[model samples]
Target: MQPLLSSYSSSSSLTIFLVSLLLVGDHGGARIILPANVTVPAVIAFGDSIMDQGANNNLNTLAKANFAPYGKDSVAGIPTGRFSNNRTPADMLVEQMGIKEFMPAYLDPSLDDKELLTGVSFASAGSGFDPQTPNLLGVLSFADQLDQFKEYIEKLKGIVGEERTQYILTNSLFLVVAGSNDLANTYFTIGIRKLQYDIPSYSNLMVSSASNFIKDIYKLGARRIVVFNAPPVGCLPLQRTLSGNEHRMCAEKHNKAAQLYNNKLQAELKHLHNTLAESKIVNIDIYKPLLAIMKNPKQYGLEVVDRGCCGTGNIEVAILCNRLLPTCLDASKYLFWDSFHPTEKGYNILMNEVVGRHASDWF
Candidate 1:
């Protein structure tokens, strides 16, 4: 993976700050400290559009930015393939924690330029734990994204020295939002294994792909991993709308497959934490939170439960998500900002539920 990557640190924006945070105590090896005068070393990110900043914008693929109505409502008010009008949950998390405002995408061509430094966002839109899905979507795969991180590490080592760079990355928080693409694209898109394998076969593939992805990030010195699971795809407006059956909801068969994969992921990840020579992995159950929110939208203050902000949730997403082609009157009111993605408000609610102190088996 290291050799397969392009030279990192070529970006002038990449630099190391001489900073450190002390672990006052431990939560059974978990590093949970008082939110006082603490310091954040760095934040490294990976996954899909949920955490993506501008990796797709630099890529010469159909899945790109360089447009409007995309970031229109965003503070930036300019498109950047973020899948949101403003900063994502990852960004919000960073800010709330008093770290940098945003993370950097290792795949961004501007890595060599230190001006672009904050944290790195390697989550390419249309990409996922399943590498092949990106090939179909024409985006970077999870493995490739990790490869970029490895290269970034090496570059940082050269720029700031290995020990210092490792220290920073080793202590940094990692928010990995992935695996959603697999459920939405694979099982539903092409009917996974319907051509060859069955549900078990495909689910196994997903577990392996995602589990290994977490391991690789760990190898790169990430200690805190918030590995998010797939959202309630069945409850998503787009899915319900596309099925065309008002009563039809997300594909239960697909959600079942996703839940199965997540369960396996949790077990395997815990085992990895137990077995790994020197590392820790934390499971961030984005799945359950989203499910709860969907089950009780009223709890989150949402009115229109079935429809997206787009005129018709289902039709609006695939066609006018960012096309300037009449979209929903308000992006905040809808659960789904687009067909397959959530609105800034939805992500905020989603992230709110994810908030709290967690840990691995170590401090």
Candidate 2:
């Protein structure tokens, strides 16, 4: 096979062309091959909608996308509770790692032993590091997800036995993506955390919670972990609609809060990386890449950035984005699928940049 890197050019034209190729069919996008020495047994994901892959389908939460218009572009044209138009960052990450085409949800009833041996997502759509975030939405909390992960370990042991389970646990790549909801929902939108703590203090609280979660997973045998920082929460279509004023510009305050939390989270990860034994913990910044895409959609072969592809694109998400509402003609041209999540094309572009820049850090 030709080297994937050889196709990459300094200009944005090739990237845009590649994105167009990705949109041609379901799961027909370019494949990402890692270095020869790198060995990732599986790819496990945990966190909010960005990483969720049908984990919310079984749950009775309004934060679900398992309906029409959600998976209109997927292989079977059926929604799988993923927040995007098709596959999410979780699916893309695993695919990029050459593990599988899709990442199954841990709660999927139809999940088989083969999927379990590979990997599955335990992430909940509305979850955050903050406990109150998930509680407010009636979705799985971080603690609940952790418990499910423990259960998954036992099942893995049953399928592959102790030795292989341990090997998979230690060798697999674990993705922790969250914090956008905590700042976007809990702190600003709901104003629940604001009463107790200001931006600085609230950010500290979030970072502390995230650190604890990482440590907990580390204790559970996660050796190579990638913790994604909060994206620019203010730039999301929902935030722009709610807080961006009449012009619907990016909310600077929310962006600042995310930046603050990201800074602290990066520092905490560094500390954990140095202190933890045989652990590879690194923080990948999704903030800048997404923000850049939003700022210059044209550079990415995207046209609409201020709104989503669903409904009016101003504020629709999850249940609000339904069959009743109409979506954009071409989701690949839009940066967001709903108000809060990126389209599959958007995710593909972002993942390409992320993996290209940070894949080496895992080793």
Candidate 3:
């Protein structure tokens, strides 16, 4: 698919293709979907806050959402350690796929019959590829998330037998969203910045860890993978608020580092797709679409661009994202829900871009 896009030297042809495809689809009653042979039976999310939902319940860290006003609009209006007030992309993905609700987070002890069989989230807020990054934020590290996954697998084997568990692995959706915390604490914060490895070296380390994690999932029976490239972290509200210079410029140095990481990740996924012939790995370009909105929020009729609706919107994210600080009167006008996340509307736009890739229509 990327090769076909490359044929059109300039991106103009790519836009032409989008238009042509839509025109043709409108003419026909049926639209092209994901490959007909594709099958997604369960969803297994691993990584960070972007996909976490109360998974950190068992962790002793400050990163938790099992409280209130979090997931407030969602099932029971209960905080689910999701770092948000409602369902996240991980949950949303499973819903779109027509799967049962996202598997329960690996932590919740109340785990019973239904939740255990559906799917689960191993994601943790503040979790990152680099182990040290989570320290500053006091959240689960990425490696810990994997340990959680292992436990889930072990339990599933108990419930559904090892042979059937293997079948579950080969047919589930493994979705990942991480790296922002690494960029924020490791590079943006002055302390971690002091011993910073060069951008290239850091990116290599990230790619290596992430790729290995993907391979581990493949070995465990995950055949369909939807991998998300890190978003343009430097452009996020948290960064903008912390920049302190008043100009909402993204930390370019950090963004470049993230870009280098994404570039490598793309190549690695292509390689993985080839090597794991029995599975399908999809790379969802989260950075590009969000960047488009960041650069031109007015195009989307978004007014509050640099700051989040949560009060001052400066450097206040996660547990700090609240009205105890300066908050916007109407959050809908803002792009970010908290300093680090998106409003429901913002998520809707992101979903449009991401879901298309999962569909057969695009990638």
Top-lDDT candidate index: 2
Better of 2 and 3 by TM-score: 2
Error of 2 at 112 (Å): 0.8
Show model 2 residue runs off by greater than 4 Å: 1-31
- Model 3 misses residue 304 by how many Å? 2.0
TM-score head-to-head 1 vs 2, winner: 2
lDDT of 2: 0.83
- CA RMSD of each candidate after superposition: 11.5, 10.4, 12.0
Name the candidate, 1 or 3, with the larger lDDT value. 3
Q: Highest TM-score among the candidates is held by which one?
A: 2
Worst 10 residues of 1 by lDDT: 18-27
Misplaced by over 4 Å in model 1 are 1-39, 107-118, 357-363
The global C-alpha lDDT for each of the candidates, from Candidate 1 onward, is 0.61, 0.83, 0.65
Q: Residues 1-363, candidate 3: write the lDDT tens digits.
A: 234235544554433322111000000111224456766557788877777767667766655546544454564655666655565676666666677545467777787856766788877776777777666555666667777678878988999999878877877667877777666556555336446676677777778888888888777777778788878777776565445345667767657767888888889988999899787787878888888887788886677867666646644555544335555666556677666777655675677666765555222
lDDT of 2 at 158: 96
- lDDT per residue for candidate 2 within 1-363, as digits (tens), equals 023224435553332221111000023345566678767788888888887888888876677889989998987899988888998878877776788889999999999999998999998888888988888777888999999999999999999899999999999999998898888878887788888999999999999999999999999999998999988888888778768867889999999999999999999999999999999999999899988987788998899998889988876677767899999999999988887888899988888878778887886
